[model samples]
Target: MLSIYIHIPFCVRKCLYCDFLSFPASERDKEIYAAALLKEIETEAFRYEERLVDTVFLGGGTPSILQTAHIEKIMDTLKNCYRFSSKPEITIEVNPCTVDKEKLSRYKAAGINRLSIGAQSVQDSELRALGRIHNAADFFAAFHMAREAGFDNINVDLMSALPGQTAERYLETLLKVTGLKPEHISAYSLIIEEGTPFFDMYGEKEGENGVERGLPSEEEERRMYEETGKRLEEAGYCRYEISNYALKGRECRHNTTYWRRHDYAGFGLGASSMVENVRWKNTARMQTYLDAYGKGKIHGNVKEEIQRLGRAEQMEEFMFLGLRLTEGVSRAEFFEAFHEDMEKIYGPVLQQLLDNGLIDTGERVKLTSYGRDVSNYVMAQFLF
Candidate 1:
């Protein structure tokens, strides 16, 4: 089954710590961009006509900012262009400040069954530090509004290791979020990305402010991650991925397609697509995207980057991505895919890691607690 991703690259304002390809909204640009997105989808539909889409995810700068009619038009185009699975999982990412009861209801009517709200943190201070437009109350109101609008499958995004954030505060935020009982929780550690305001204001100006004004240290971040896993487990949420927790049967299908290396289609500015073992991305420039579409130049947006993966690269990706799961990569599946036993390929490394108490092997190869703590280092060992 295939998955579809639509990027909406407009937000009210950029977050201080965000380096995503997005811009502030403009009426003229929004109108042009939406039309271009529709055109891009139509142009690429023929390529995936034989495939069935199991998941449809509308992600963005802020998909919730679009008008209901615009969203509906996009959905209508998708329905006309592609065949969906009998029980497709459709999701849309929303910013709390951009949505209300009416918009949420319209989104549901447009065939979006899942909502992923960007509620980075529920603390006002943390929100301000991250340069978020909405406060904690706004997020709560949006969540309630989404529920009222008949959305049952909901995901909330949270962040740990924020500037000036303490472990106590992080735990408190986690407790408050779990109290809401969302179906999915995505907790990511803050990364001070280059080109972001936060990186310039704090990261680049190192030594200007005390440690309290910067991101949490590696040790503290690791503690927060381990504690999060423990807390979420206690709350009946399974760690399906390193940073993603879900109630049983609530794992995100679209994201799973990615980790599993399945084919998918992406439309809109800066959206990346993987089809027929070929991966490509659209231009990130909004004006360029609109101009090309207006000139009936749909193919102009696509940049063919990786045509296919070699055996070594594929194996490396398979192990790394699969290891992100708590259950880890299945030895049987690896052999089936590669026609070689994983143990045979990396026997010495596996034995060494096991001897070092970094990995466990049974039906599958998985990182132990220590390995999980230093997953990046462990993954690097498998790379060719």
Candidate 2:
């Protein structure tokens, strides 16, 4: 089975820390972009007629910013072009400030069954520091509106290690999120990407006046990750992946398909797709995408750069992606896929990690508390 990702690359205003390929919306551009997206969908549907699609995710610059009619148009286009499974999981990413009760109701009616709300933090000051427009009250209102609109499956996105975040504040934010009782929670550590405003401000201001302007220290970040796992699990939210927690059977099938190396198609400007062992991306510029689509440029900006997976790449990816799961990879599944014994492939590294109390291996190999704290390092050892 395959999953589909539709990129809505339009936002009301770009956030300070965001470096994604998106721009503020204009009436003409929105119409043009939506049409181009449908065209690309048609192109992809014809290209991959053999695969069954089970999940569809609409991520972006904040899909909530779109009007109900625009969303319905996209869904209608999908129905016309491709076949969806009986019960496909259709998810849309929403920002708190952009959604209202009416819009939420219309979204459910438009066939969106899942909502991923962007609630970075509950604290107003923290939200401002992160350059988010909404306050905590707005997020609460949006969450209630989603429930009122018949959305039972909801995911909340939270960020840790902000510019002025403290351990106590971060814990408070997590507790508040858990109190809301979402089905899924994705907690990510803030990374200051190079071109973003946060990066420029913090990167230039550091060490000038004893300023601590960047991300949290390595030690602090590790502590935050460890505490996050412990707290979420205690709240009855299982840590299915390093950065994600969910109740039973609530794991995101779309994202899991990627981690498991399943085929998927992506549409929109700057979107990437992996199908039939070939990976390619669309052009990033809006004008370029529209021009190519309007001119019947079927393979515009597409390049097939195929890298056949050898033993090392496959094994390394399996270990890295599998270890992201708290339950870890199954020994039977590993051997079935690779035709090699897991114990024979990297026995020394596993033994070293297990001996150091960083991982546990019984039925399935999983990260111990120490291992989760230093997961990147543990994953790095398996890369070669």
Candidate 3:
């Protein structure tokens, strides 16, 4: 089985904190980009012919911003290019403001079996602070509209530790979204990535080593994370991944493929893929991608940057990505895949983590409750 990812790199307006390869484009530009994206998908599918693509994820700069016709064409192209599993899990990432009853209905009609609504916060004030176009009202409307369109498998995205956010406000977001009973919830803590408005505003300190302003304290952030797990669990959504909670049997299969280190192909601008030992990301520049599409080949420079991971690199990724899940990695599977005993190679590192209560050193190693709080450190030890 294989997974396919399509990246739609157009947004109505780039959010303040977003640093993805998304841009504001006119409708005509969208049409051009969509045509090119379909071409890439066709070319890649031919390279790996006849394989069953079990999962397809349309993620973006808000894929909902694309016209229904564009989406339908993309779906049609995938079906024509490859064999689909009998029960393909097709998902589209949508923004609250970009969709409506008709658009969602068209999505269902186009074979999108899942919806991931980017409802970052349920509070209007927080949404405004985050420079998000949509508000609480918009999210509710979108949620109901998705349900009305017959989407049973839905994932609501939320963020905690936001600027000017209190513990009370974070809990409010959790309670409100969970009350809606979406099949999954991705509650993430805000990270101030570089080259974004957030980094410019808060990344600089007034004086030497001055404390960061407007953000919650580390202790406060910890509270928000812990409480989120408790609240979502009580609401019947189990914590599956570090930031993902889902009802039983409704996890995002496409994302799970990444964690399991399975092969996946990414299409469109700035899309990346890990097929066997080779890993590559498409050109992020718009004109570059268009030029490549025109020439019927990915640009030479972009293709030249491809990384063929060595054995150590593969093991590092296998451990780091697999450890993000609550179920963790199996030693047996690791040996089968890498032909190296995990215990023999990493026994001391595993012992150190276990001694500090970061991971459970069992047949299948996984994070302890306390370990998940400091998962970064645990995963870093696996790095080559």
Candidate 4:
């Protein structure tokens, strides 16, 4: 089975902390992009026609920003072009301000089984700081509307360590979101990427005595991260992945495909694809992409940065990616895929990690809580 990701690069406005490939566009620009996206999907389907699609993730600059007809057309195109599994999981990323009950209801009709609402915080001040177009009240209304629109499996996206945010304030946001009992939650810490407004405000600034200004200190950020697992588990959610919590049987299947290194195809501007160990990304240049698809030349010039993974590189990916899960990598599966015993490849490294109490060894090797705190370091050890 294969998974598919479609990117929608339109938004009402850009958020200060965001560096994603998204921007506000006119209706005509959206219409043009949608047309090109449809053609690309149609052209690509010929290559993966035999593969059964199990999951479809519509990610974006707020996919909910699209008109209902546009979204319906896109879903229709996908349904007609691909052979889907018996019950496919289709998810769309939504901005609270962009969706209403009618829009959400149409989404359900379009076979979108899951909703991922981006509610970064439940504080109006934080929302304003992030330059989010919606307030806390708007998120509540959107959630209620989604539930009313018949979406049972939903995920709420939250962020901690925001500008002027404290652990107590983050905890309150968590409690408020959990009170609604969404099936899944994704909580991420803020990262100040270069070129983003946040990079200038927080990334470059140094507070008194070498402290960071306008954001939570590293100590408080650590507290927020640690408390996330504890509090979510207390609220009946399981931390299946490092940054994701979900109720039993409600984890995101689409994202799981990525962590498991399964084959997935991405469509639209700046989309990426991996199939049969070969990976490539679509051209990020919007005009270039549109022109290629518009002219019906879907092959060579559309793709850039293609690479086929060698055996060692594939093994490294399998190790590091799978380790992100709480259950970690399976020794048996690794041997099955690579035909090499896990212990034989890195027995010494494993021994050191075991001695340091960073990992638990057995049929399935998993990180200790301490190891997860330093996951980058632990994952780096697998690189050969």
Candidate 5:
């Protein structure tokens, strides 16, 4: 399946923990960016004109910050440029403060069938501490507005392991969100990046300016993670993939494309695309992208970096990426795709993982719950 991603790198306020390319921008700046994005999409869509697009994800900084008409223009342009499935899973990532009921109505009218709302926490204090521009009330309002606007497929984005977060408090957010019964939910743990405010506050030695950030202790974070899974599982939301829970038949198809190693095209600022066995990332610098696109550089060569994968590279990626799924990678499919037995190349490693009780060696290999706890380390063993 072929999917598409559009990055909107404009946020109302950059959260303290954010390391994505999004930042605060004026309406005029966003409009200009959208225009540039349109140009890129119009030019690049032709390359995949023959492929029936399965999903189109409008991810952000915050896509809802765009005016409804701008969104409509982009969707219209995409429809004009490519062949989409009769029922494409078109999703837009929305920030609560940016969209009202009327705006949500406009979004529905504009063909956004799914909404991924960023509602990080339910506590007003945590919202402020996380640098979120909206309070819990704002999220509730936005969520109900989307429902009133007729969105049946919605995903609420939640974060755990935040500073000053307790296991009970985090569980409360999970329980409260699950009560809404959105079609999907994505929960992520806070990882401190080197340059962000979070890292600065917690990175240095305690004797230095690195006072306690009130970050959840590692053990508390582990409890939060376990409870997250247990609660969601009991709520009837299947843990289809790590970090995501969905009703059966309601997984985020666009993201699944990534984990399943399907081809996709990405547009807009700092987007990444992998098609025709080559992976490339767009230039992250806003002015740099604008300059190139402004000069008619929408072709494949416009990206910041492009790399072609060898057979070995592809196989490793297939194993690691597929392992991220609860179902794990299929050995038969691996042989069919690469024409080599997966066991032949990674037999020893697989045996080790199985012996350690980190993975199962049935018809397909999958991670155990213990494996998922050290998944980063487990997955890295696949790299050769």
Candidate 6:
């Protein structure tokens, strides 16, 4: 089986803290891009005809911003080109206020079974500070609209550790979301990426004056993170992955396929795909991609940064990615895939991690609570 990711890299407005590959586009530009995407999907379908596609994720710069007809056409084309499984989980990522009840109802008719709403923060002040186009009331409207439109499987995306955000305030946001009890919740801490506005205000160069500038202190940030896990768990949502929580049976299967190192294809600008140990990413340049499709060259000319993983690389990935799950990596499955005993290869490293109380080992190996707190350092240990 395989999963498919379709990227729609257009948004109404770029947020201040976002560094994703997204931008504002005109309606004409969107029409042109959608045509190119359809051509690419048809072109790439032949190679994966033998596999059954079980999940389709429409992600990126607010897919819900598009006209309902565009989304319906895209889904129709996918159903035509690929052989899907008996029950496919089709999801679309939406921003509040970008979609109305009518648009959401059309999406349901088009076979979209899941909705991921980008409700970063519920506080109006925080939403404005982050430069979000939607306010708190818009999020509530969107959620209720989705329910009225018949979407039961929904995921709400939340973020913590914002500038001027306190732990108590973070809990307030958490409790408000938990009250709704969406099937899934993804809570992430804000990271100051180099190219975003938040970086200029809070990056290390200005760290000496950070506290005066309203950025949360390290103690407050850590407390916020701890509180997120505690509050979400108390609400009966299980933390199946570091940043993702779900009320049983709602974990995102597409994302889990990525963590388990399964074969999946990505379509659209700057999307990445990995299959049978070979990986490639589509060109990020918009006009370059359009020109390729114009010239009837969607297959080869549009692909870039292709690499084939060697055995060592595969083993490294098996450990690094699989360990991210709360259940950890399976030893028997590791041996079955690599044809070697995992202990024979990384016994010393495992022993060190075990001794340091960073990981626990049983039939499967997984991070301890403290280990997950410092997951970056723990995951880095798997690199060769």
**Each prediction's TM-score versus the true structure:** 0.95, 0.91, 0.96, 0.97, 0.96, 0.98
The whole-model lDDT of each prediction reads: 0.87, 0.83, 0.88, 0.91, 0.88, 0.91
Two-way lDDT contest, 5 vs 6, winner: 6
Task: Sort all candidates by TM-score, best to worst.
Answer: 6, 4, 5, 3, 1, 2
Error of 1 at 62 (Å): 0.8
- lDDT, candidate 5, 228-253, per-residue tens: 99999899999978899998899999
State the number of backbone clashes in model 3.
0
Q: After superposition, how far is residue 111 of candidate 4 from its true place, in Å?
A: 0.6
**Model 2 residue 176 lDDT score:** 91
For model 2, residues 190-273, the per-residue Cα lDDT tens digits are 866779888777764333421465456656666777789889989989878888999888998888877777778888888877
* Stretch of 10 with least lDDT, candidate 2: 204-213
- Name model 3 segments beyond 4 Å from true: 204-212, 295-304
- Candidate 1 or 3, higher TM-score? 3
Query: Model 4 residue 352 lDDT?
Result: 93
Residues 1-384, model 1: lDDT tens digits = 789999998899999888887779788778778888888889888878889989999998898788878899999999999999998999999999889899899888989999999998999999999999999999999999999999999999999888878888999999999999999999988877778888776664334442556667667777888789899999999988878999999999899888878888888888898776667887776667777786556654455354677788888888888888888899999999999999889899889989999899988999988888788988888988
TM-score of 4: 0.97
Model 6 spans > 4 angstroms off: 295-300
| Candidate 5 least-lDDT 10 residues | 204-213
Worst 10 residues of 4 by lDDT: 204-213
- Which candidate, 2 or 5, has the higher lDDT? 5
Runs of candidate 5 with Cα error greater than 4 angstroms are 204-211, 295-301
What would you estimate as the lDDT of candidate 5?
0.88
Native-vs-model 2 lDDT? 0.83
lDDT for model 4 comes to 0.91
lDDT-wise, the better of 1 and 3 is 3
CA shift of 381, model 2, Å: 2.0
- Candidate 2: which stretches are off by over 4 Å? 204-211, 214-223, 295-311
Compared with the true structure, what per-residue lDDT tens digits does model 6 show for residues 51-114? 9999999999889888889899999999999999999999999999899999999999999999
